[model samples]
Target: MRVSSLLRFRSTSLQTSIAKQQQYVPQHKPAVQDDIKRLEDFLISKPNILVLSGAGISTESGIPDYRSEGVGLYARTNHKPIQHLEFVKSSSVRKRYWARNFVGWPNFSSTQPNATHHALARFEREMRVQAVVTQNVDRLHTKAGSRNIVELHGSGYVVKCLSCEYRIDRHEFQTILATLNPAFKDAPDMIRPDGDVEIPVDYIENFHIPECPECGGNLKPEIVFFGDCVPRPRLDKIAEMVYNSDGLLVLGSSLLVFSGYRMVLQMKDLKLPVAIVNIGDTRADHLADIKISAKCGDVIPKLFDFRKTNPL
Candidate 1:
């Protein structure tokens, strides 16, 4: 999904608005309980499990998944890749991007990790989950307490100089952006889940773009933008974990992106035990060993609850 499609955000306010707009679908209904039960038992036997996650895990926290029905996070603009070239080549475009973020930040930043995130955290406490390979940039898993995690896409919490690679805290970058584009502080009106802000091109043109503090160069959000590739190191880390694992539990992810889908294929070819919990059709459904088609919010909490309360 395009960054813009995710949501217009630089902070949690963006999260509040998205939560208000999107409805939480009840998950883990009867259609998927058997699979959930089987998955719960399997974890008890294996103990050492590796978890792979995507946006679905974060949806319960109020962020919208890219492919879900209804007006998606990036519905109006359509999901289009925001490239490095556009940001560096056109000041107007970059300004608009920042403006969109300024208004959308609060709603996006306000989100908390949900039950699935906490379940993983609790499971990790049992010393069973080996690693967390996630496609989400939301950092909910980390907030939930999973330490051994690999973000296949870079995080949104930082920013870098596009020209110099000097990093800055996203908070610092936000200050600079707000200072330079004072007019845009209140300009944004639309929010998306991936945290992209929707603002007008005219507003962008009128805004003053900020320069990097270190080199007086262009700065971009420290995230893996669409059309940009994940570096080799991140992919290698995921592959290493997945290949080394006895089982792979894909929770709350549709596995649509090639970065993730390729990993799934890698696991399948290696014949690793693969299971999934997601609400919609996914590229890996046919490939999964145990497919539990349900909402993760309903499923994960219940799965853990069952593991604790019942003998199964």
Candidate 2:
């Protein structure tokens, strides 16, 4: 049989799977079979679907997101992410940030993609998805084998010289960090969503932040930090992907951040179908053609199977 024949999802089995994963399902408004059916229909109708993902998708992978209620980093703690201007302007801030990041790096770097990420990768492999545009700095999608991806906020897996634009893999940078802070212990209160931790002031005072070896300039993670704009070229690329796709499928994002929210707006402007599968109300809820309040991990893995639907 053709591989396309395996794409149809058995509704009863899918629903049963969703029901079995109730621990991961949202309590407020769990997704019904109808919602899955609609989404399945949407996927079949729109072969070249563009996925716009956010932090929620990685939460299943043990990384915290900033905005989810009660469980998110913001709700659970008073910490805020490093702002771009602050990191650029203050030496002390960078010192503190790097110290925390050094402590948290191992745990953050070890995070593996969960079912949602794997499912998205499968979608791309099956030619159902064109690309995944993620606001997350974590490269979980790529780690999960998604090749056609646009890291809208850049990635934590890369470091760059702010002055000269020289880039290096984050692993190599971490090795440099290890050499610089050989005495630093790995103790942390907890790892924050951005792969940093709340370290003691003493650690910050003693920590050595690495400068770019080639230029003696500041080294920064390639992520688009809060209060910074996404580079124009990345925006253009995402726009091109958006224009090329027949529909938009949002997974695990509240879309409160304008960077991810604007994609939904663009899809609406293009008169394309927009389907969202998230736990709570998203900024684009009113505009979405279908909004299913369910965990992406629970629902996404069941999206592809053999049950018979219109051919893509």
Candidate 3:
């Protein structure tokens, strides 16, 4: 009769259509129905819900994620990273890494947060999501309007002088890097999604790894390098929120990294239920109470409607 009523009618008709399709499915999807109810009930209860997000949440924003075959960020930025220690010890490694990052900054910073990011932002606004703990350095979760976010890894938008510890904005550092590595100017190199590049070996060997203009310390991107540990304060912040929250929601993480995997273990210790909406078997698959093998784009939007107690 009216727009609102018409929309509701269409919703009912769609449910009927889905129910009919369910009847044709070979296996009964009782679990699917149950999961939807659990999700809705949990949200309706308004328990503090903590988010543990990975790259998958940002994939829809045109930002590449890791592990989704054609959609993964790593597959695009397949260049192997030189370890922080190695870079520090070998001038060659530092020069090469920084040179590549300098060229890649524009593309990386230009990426905007996507639907899944916006959905999480909405959840926070709706008071359904209390906090976010993420492994991504892109800072998308915060960009999405998540107020309380603990970044287990460092942010890509920052670079610090190894000696001075002065954090400079990534763009400012890129200009400094460009001035120092002039050999890479107009040089042909392959660019990748994660803001990394493939370049000639000699270019790095001769390039100077500059000192901090303010403090005379060696310069480095602030991101948590492979083999580096996340600071204790960051870990404590996540633990505090998780302990207080009613449930945990993991999005798009494979959990190959220990920082994220540890959160699953923490939930186990707290006896709090963990629900995962990832595309693959993460290290926490056995730990999660509800595992949705779907993309974040699909799962997060539907979470607005799904619940735990649907009357048969």
Best by TM-score: 2
Give each model's clash number: 30, 2, 8
Candidates' C-alpha lDDT: 0.74, 0.82, 0.72
On lDDT, the candidate that comes out on top is 2
Candidate ordering by lDDT (highest first): 2, 1, 3
Give each model a TM-score.
0.83, 0.87, 0.79
For residue 130, what is the lDDT in candidate 2? 95
Ranking by TM-score: 2, 1, 3
Error of 1 at 242 (Å): 1.6
Put down candidate 3 lDDT per residue, 1-312, tens digits, no spaces: 999999999999978755532221122122254565566666667558888898766655545554556435445556564576886787667777776776667766776676678778788887888988888888887777778788888899888887765788888777776787777676435563233467667766776666777878777777788877788888898888878988888888888889899888988898888888776678889888888776666557666743533635
Candidate 1, run of 10 with poorest lDDT = 21-30
